[model samples]
Target: MNAKNSIAELARWIDALPNTRRLAGHELHNYRKQFVDGWRIDLNLAENVSINLLITAQFPFVSPKIALIDRTKFLSWPHVEKDGCLCVFPPNTNVDPYRPVEVAKSLVAETEALLQCLLDGNLDDDFNREFDSYWLLSSDDLRHQFFSILPDGCDSQKVAVWSSSKFRIIGADEKSVLCWLKNRLQKDYDRTDTGFLVKLSKPLSPEEYPDCTEALLALISEDAPNFLESISDHIAKSFQPLTIILAISATNGTNYGVVELCRLLRANEKVSKCGRSNRVSVNGFRDGKAPLSVQLSQQTKYTKVVRSPLERADAEWALGGRGHDPRFAVLQKQRVAIVGLGSFGSFLTDNLIQAGLGQVAMFDGDLMRWENTGRHLLGGDTVGQNKTDALKRRFETNYPTIVSCESNPVDWQQRIETAESLDGFDLVISTTGSWKAECMLNDLHECSGKRTPIVYAWLEPFAAAGHAVAIMERSGCLQCGFTGAGQFSRRVFDWPAAPTTMVSQAGCGNEFQPYGITDSLHSIAMAVDLSVECLLGQLTASTHRVWINKDRKIDPIQRGWSVAWQTVPNFDTREEVVSEFPWSARPDCQRCS
Candidate 1:
């Protein structure tokens, strides 16, 4: 048949098939194209192929059958049965058959498998084994039977067709024809070459592995060949020795456990990468037979103590006159308030307390829930206890002399009011996103008589991202820092078009969700660094400052830029300070004006 006539005939056959008819015209066209274009199969072979279809419209469906007429070169079931009748079944068949859709799905899947088998080389031993049972039938008998069963006047020798068959004829050779029979009959072996096999040998054992320090040196030597040979003397001179500490758990016995340490050391008055050391230590109680915990302490001249906030304050004060205390210079008189006492808030409060803040206040309205055991700083026994009260109790227990305030009824709104009640603080930190509370605080700082510095830090859902905004009074408030509004002297507070409700129920709330320990640690580090900088008068008094480290490619250090503040007609005011406590112009604000 001509190409056009063959295509028309194939199109008619496909349209008559119930499964093919259900697919959209475009989808069916694409499906046909996958074989004709992708596989590059010869259309002439369709006329000589006798196709049979068996669809199981049940729980587990099967594919249709296909066979080659006049040529029994490569034939296998369900393409050719024991009696030489073609039978096709689906890819995965259970005891029960489902529906026609399921049967069609099986046909498509099996067809894909057949195509892949053809590509990977048809010397499949399993296919040969499965076809052995039907090998007894003579090739002439198979051809005669196929031609007889075909549609009247349909010359089997001239018709080449494609069908959904588990068995597929791939190629014809002088000796034996290549085909994909059934998965169970095909050999499930990987034909990797010798070179690949050698490379796939077992990995070196831990003890047999090269030392990390040596491996690093070797890598540098190979990667920097040109530089290494030329700078051998300079490299030697650059080498420096430094110490590091490797913390190990008790379960890791000595001798069997390894400790790795790498550090930067001073060389020629500059810090450079020094060599690393690895050692295996055995536990003393294990008779040296079992692995022992290994801990390595790098030797250093300076001794640093991680102390609580009050202790750090006292230490700084005692050493301030001597000029030897970095804390004295960093924490002179820093005041910090933490709003929200859930997992994130509690973690931040504890860290700040340890950082030696002069004064710290924690605020939260919700009580601890049973689900907070893993996230909360409080013990599981403290479940159902007020989060603020529990945090305060934990703080007092750890540091009796430290002065910490716990505000139970003070939600974000009351917290802002409470903050206003206290003496003007240097920095106000808030983790809660209570819109009402944030609005109140923004208004108070914007129009209130007091001009206290405010910093807002929050973690996005799943702790995937964190946002921090440092607002210098009259400089750039949170609303002004938003990308929408450029630098403006007049505060532009745009409320969200739709109200965003934060879930409060224990397990269902988003805000109440606890961040991973690593995220919490990172948040604490950022909060502490910013607060310390503000306390030390290191922060720029710019109108806008945003702290973000989303892209790891960027330096992980605390860095930000300043934007010039522009004057807005209704917002900018050069008045030294508001004369009255409550300004009437911002009366439209739902929070305090």
Candidate 2:
């Protein structure tokens, strides 16, 4: 906090001014006492605008708040805010807060320059110089009649205009206000008779911008040809805030709602206020072809603006810090193949999305049924949709790297059996709990010289337990963990010889292994961790991981819980069943470990 000049120097400087007076017992803003030996003076900065400069205790350390003392006589300008503050300096460019005299002198210099710019009728350049900051005045005033939400990073030359809450923007209209409304607002538009249309711009940059009254109307006239007649009909019929938003695509592909860009102009002696009468006249315009020009009430003051989306995705990302960690950079190049879209696979897919998969390819042949609503990610509304398609759409919308495969794993395996190899994936996951599908994937993984690692997971009947096997390239394949008959390879914990865990949904043919959504979620949780570990190149061995709920078995005669949650002979009586289940792959298996 090295201040450039002291209070005495500032006082000496202020004393030389003509209309200055020392004020005592003063306070600045809501806090603190003002300078006991400070000057309050008025300076004639411009011909019409006068400046009242007050030197508080904070003085040069903090820039003085400047305002035009007698502003009624001066014309409204882009550099002049409603409060008479001049846009003389850049936003938030406090070089040295502690340097009092330096800051004070700089403020005065900028104010002087701003006054010159205003007098020269060149204030519009100031607005364009800091366009984002100038818009702050109207950003908080939310009374605008029309709005649009544009997607970020889209290369669009389109529009979405709403009239009477219905998007009548179609064909030639879409090029107007092109984008908004989140999910809920979008649902409202869907229930109505609104439609979107694209209206392309030819070398489109607003010619006389910040002067929306002229530029926007001209744009509408140039594009639609009959837009002004329609606007004149509506203005004649109503006194309500008649807003017609023209959301055009920006050059940089970023989205913003076009609200306005106002530029002040000379007043017309014969002009009438908006909605006064249909038979109207405007200043300096000889033709009635541009009807919007007649709507002007004041001849000297005007403003024009281009609206932009207030809610930006990049802003949210900046605030939330999502997907920004350097640690996750390692996983950015990892490619994954998820082989099922059932309850287990869908939830596993969701976990992958949250954890940030770089490139993913999903394969599933089943359509989502009503029964799947209880445990599926696709939801009840997507009851008849293909599970892979639904999940792929969801991921690609948010993640941008997910691709839909041509077919399911089984069909895809057949097509590429004689090609240059299907081993390009970094990791392949299986969660189908289908023995046939598992066998085919295992066979694919068993092919020699392939480098793709595999992680297979399943929930036992009733979800009383779950298991995951992470097998690396050239390690034991899925076949090594079983005898190809639904039997685990000598599990540390064994199942009942005659298991009766099936529940009938539509008789015996439709019976399924009953499990709650939560139980399935827990299984996927373990599977996700193991898959991530393998992708990070941390896990190398072909091993088995399992979760066991102690009360899974029950007695048929007594209807009591069974303690038959038994493993092999060397079970430690003290260890927790849910945490410790590591079964080793056999060395003499067909698919060599």
Candidate 3:
């Protein structure tokens, strides 16, 4: 229905209610914009409070918004935004377009219920739960200016701070914060200042929240006295702005708040230094500095402070805490080595890194060329760079949750020959699609006593099929799937004329199979799924997974399905599908048996 009709229906519905009325000209004119229109609702509360049912322009598509009119006292309530909107529904709440009146009724009901809870003080405890939301209610442009990487703990201690002209970063230690700074700034930093970290047992309510520098100190002295003592001297004597980081522990998680003491001055102090009236001098003597204990009490009453928002920038918070992805807690401890950074490997590496792996060591000898951009994750920006190096820089810059991203600009074969052992990695993935490299990786697995699982993935010509084979200890060897001549012994499909379709843009030996980027999605997914399964200990035996592009129409003159595929039921009718098969060591295989 049109918006005008919907609003008319809504107005008729609200007219049936006793306490609600359509706002008159003056009040109605204020809300008669293209984006919103609504009637005022006089909530049946003890105090004279009213709310507006704001029917948005997208009316039925988006549920009506509820806004509290008398917002002065309600500002401290949970889920109340700075502009007086009551966030009654959780994020991603769906709306039924056909039931616009019912949707509006439900939202109004939820708002009233929430307001009643506020009246009874039942939601005061929720202040801690929605601490960050309330903390960011300030209109300050510096709300998102500070970032904290401090480790999660209740014990208060000193933290490292890196200050720029507009931004500041707080970290648990010097080395970690410096590393983060280097990664972000792309430069070396040798110096850092100290900040006081104060742990609050509980977050403060809006009324208890501090507004000025003196109020912050009062809060620290009241709740975090022990921490305040440790940093009192540092704050009193600092010539530059001093930082205080609050790690308020809430039931959901820790919420960080940052306040900077921009200036220190006494009641009668002026902007002067090294003079009789200078606060820096001891007892009006220019030669001596004031005592630490007295400086805070006597001269810091009017200290100017900037309250900025604090973001948790550490890997732990980014990977596991924010998204609630439990895999990070386990996968972040495991190390995986990717032996290639081509089209297949590059995307596979990206998937693993985004999954929050702790350490990912990439090895690839090839440099990215313009031809690889269509299928490869590394794009034109890194066309001339080594694949591994370019990917390393890209991943680290993009995925901050990745604790360690190492790149080796050498072939996997050469890396294995030089390294002590491949056993150090939890798993090794080879997506180079080279049989020779796969054989060498198999040897490395054997040399490591099968300590590390290995996954080999490749796409057939035209991407008609893709396969991922996992080699586990005592289960099978890489040769189990292939004959000594590098052809699958139990191939799913056969295309004997596929070799004739190979195209070479650079040279005769540097030929690449023709396939669109979309055709290889299944291949990359298969490899990534198998790799994660192996790392998570979900796969106990060697296995092979194959993805068949059932929609692909083969050239009947030269290509056809293999005999092995024909035996499968409904093989011809099936759409794109992934089939799993057990991989066991072949009895006649010279490598394993």
Candidate 4:
């Protein structure tokens, strides 16, 4: 078939796919148009393949040749000479005449596999290997070479290994596993009613492997009942030291029971104290005054330390505990503002609430529409309710003590007003639909000179998945940080007269479309958890901006991770300006600025 007929056939095939009809149709048409024009086939193909598919197809034998064509575009692979020819050939089989349909099928399958790999978090070792192999391969060579790059091992065995072992190792490490478990517990258990116990066994001597085994058995036997009785068996387990870590569900002062158990173990002389308290505390073996003395408390005798009101006051004064320790209280009392009440924003709000954020201000001018029910947090009963109001109601019901404020009748303008109203808020977060909305919040923070941090969380549907949190302080504002014009800005400037539907495609329409809630929830939890780290001062200035790309599908999944911050000199050496240039400047911006 000629290029036109081939393109027509592919268009029909793409139309048959479930929901890709529109995008495929457009891409196919563009392919034909570019092909018909003088556009180089190689360049077109490189541009056409989505970034997600390109990353996935890194492996030679396992990936596909994704091409971009603009009608009648016909060119041989870059590795092939002037006469159309292929640099690679089929292995173990005769190279029958090449067919376009076969090539298309290979591309689609490779893209699908890449997406699956990304979702399963199984792309690490394969990433660099694929990149090195394909860095010089021509397009046609890529199409054929990928199939030949499969390892010599049996496919079934490889599948089993991937499913069981290698897959688990993708995101598993001591630090990541512990962090994941802590996040899980915070979401699953009530903050005020649960406590965790980390029990350490006696350290084994160099020649005590047998004794260690026996101690392990004994510790497992003692901990089995508690584990089996727990509501969920998904408790994270890690074997490092011979330690038993237990998270006990508590109500009121039931946490004290775990504390007492730790004290009892310490007193028995059978177990040595490794750590203690509601928060983990390192125990020192001896005081500075005694070189060889171990500070041991009396057994079964708990001391109050302070017997009278005056003594209690003095102890509090010494520790600087006026009402609550400022460090702990600050995290527990953060006031977060969710600027958009759309699908992604609503999901983020749910995660922030579940993560024990004390105060949340929801701002949105949109009313709950029927189309929103598919993906929004608020459902049937809230069809016509304001989005912010519905979110506030749900939040208050789940956490009665949580302070929720709804800023209805609020657009980007009113958002500024709402932000100004907040007194001593630690952070301002934006998930608004409009880039202008994000810019407004950025401007608000700059104008206030309050040094309050700002975080912008969002997900780009299908193509990219992750939220970008910018801690707007010393780091540049959102607009300044944007490397290129986003799709929305492009649509506004490239085709100012485009219809609303076209503009919507480049804007908020896809965000409202349905997706797996689990993935959405996972991304939101990551963003919120990182925000908590920022609030607690766990993240350094060098590691503040985080990008959680949910779309990574290579062998080693590179989900959103932190990017180090650049160094800034001390402010004393530079002249300080109070003018609104930082707040109001929109130089070279077509969107928010």
- Among these predictions, the greatest TM-score belongs to 3
User: Between 1 and 3, whose lDDT is larger?
Assistant: 3
lDDT of 2 at 247: 34
Q: 121, model 2: CA deviation in Å?
A: 33
What candidate 3 gets wrong by more than 4 Å, as runs, is 19-21, 24-35, 46-48, 139-144, 264-283, 321-323, 418-420, 500-511, 554-558, 564-575
Question: All models: lDDT?
Answer: 0.38, 0.52, 0.74, 0.39
lDDT of 1: 0.38
Task: State every prediction's TM-score relative to the real structure.
Answer: 0.34, 0.49, 0.89, 0.36
List all candidate RMSDs to the true structure.
28.2, 12.8, 3.9, 25.5
Candidate 4 global TM-score: 0.36
lDDT of 1 at 274: 45
Candidate 3 local lDDT, 365-470, one digit each (tens): 9999999999889889998899999988888777644678888999877667733468778998888777677766776676667868888888765676788889
* Model 2 per-residue lDDT at 223: 61
Candidate 2 whole-model C-alpha lDDT, 0 to 1: 0.52
Question: Per-residue lDDT for 1-593 in model 2, tens only?
Answer: 33335566656666776776555443223223342344455645656445645444554555655555545422246665554545556666665666555666677778777777777877554444434444444453344333233333333233334445333222123332221222112223432212222233542322233344455556666665555555444332323333343333433332233443323333442323653333343455542434453544332134434343243332113222332554355555667778777788788876765565556677777787888877788787677888877776565544332222223533345443631354767788887776666777777667634477778888655565577888775555677667655455533333344344331110111125455687567667888988888877877676567665445345222222223334343433332244534445568766545
Model 2 stretches astray by more than 4 angstroms: 1-303, 306-323, 327-332, 396-420, 448-450, 490-511, 550-585
State how far residue 476 of model 2 sits from its true place (Å). Answer: 2.4
Worst window of 10 by summed lDDT in candidate 3: 502-511
lDDT of 1 by residue, 1-593 (tens): 34344334434555554433222334224321122211111222223222222222221222333322223333322233343333334334442232334444455455445534433545243333332232223111121111001111111111111112222121112111111111212323222100000010122222222234334224335433443332222222222211111111122210111111223333333432443322222234222233211211112111121111001112232334323546654553566667667666677667666665546667678888777766667878778778887776676555432433455535756545654553456677776754445545666666654366666665443343344556664344554433222111222221122122321111112644444555445655665666666666777663222222233323222222212213332332222221111112333323322
